[model samples]
Target: MPFAQIYMIEGRTEEQKRAVIEKVTAALVEAVGAPKETVRVWIQDVPNTNWGIAGVTAKDLGR
Candidate 1:
């Protein structure tokens, strides 16, 4: 089995979430030789306030 873990700021649309899973599964099937059914994807969503980059939070990106 192949496993993928994706972490990102929260507030993604349901379609976006589904796309993530589908793409990861396809990659695992093609690259890792894992069956689509055996590919496992785990998504961890963090709040904007909890995610920071270069001393700026995701919420700060809009500014």
Candidate 2:
């Protein structure tokens, strides 16, 4: 089994997230020859307040 954890800012639509999941799953399947059913992907959507860049929060950066 192959597991992937993806972290991103928390503002994408459901469709977008679905697309990401599908693409990531496909990548894992192709790259490592993992079975489609055995590939696990977890998307972690972090709030802007909890995400930081260059010593500033994403919220503070208006991201």
Candidate 3:
């Protein structure tokens, strides 16, 4: 089995997230020869306030 974990700010629509998962799974299947059914993609969304970059939070940076 192949597993992928992606972290990003919480703002994308459901369709976009689904597309990401599908694309990531396909990539893993092609690159690592993992079975399509055994590929797992997990997306973890964090609030802007909880994500920081440089000296400020993502919300403060207008992300």
Q: In terms of lDDT, which candidate is strongest? A: 2
Candidate 2 residue runs with Cα over 4 Å from true position? none
Q: Per-residue lDDT of 1-63 in model 1, one digit per residue for the tens?
A: 788999988898989999999998998898878878889999999899888889998788852
Alpha-carbon local distance difference test for all models: 0.88, 0.97, 0.96
Clashes of each: 0, 0, 0
Top candidate, metric TM-score: 2
Q: In what order do the candidates fall by TM-score, top score first? A: 2, 3, 1
- How far residue 3's Cα lies from its native spot in candidate 1, in Å, is 1.0
Q: Write the per-residue lDDT of candidate 2 for residues 1-63, one digit (tens) a residue.
A: 999999999999999999999999999999999999999999999999999899999999999
Q: Higher-lDDT candidate among 2 and 3?
A: 2
Give the TM-score of each candidate.
Answer: 0.89, 0.96, 0.96
Considering summed lDDT, which 10 consecutive residues are worst modelled in model 2?
Answer: 32-41
True lDDT of residue 52, candidate 1: 88
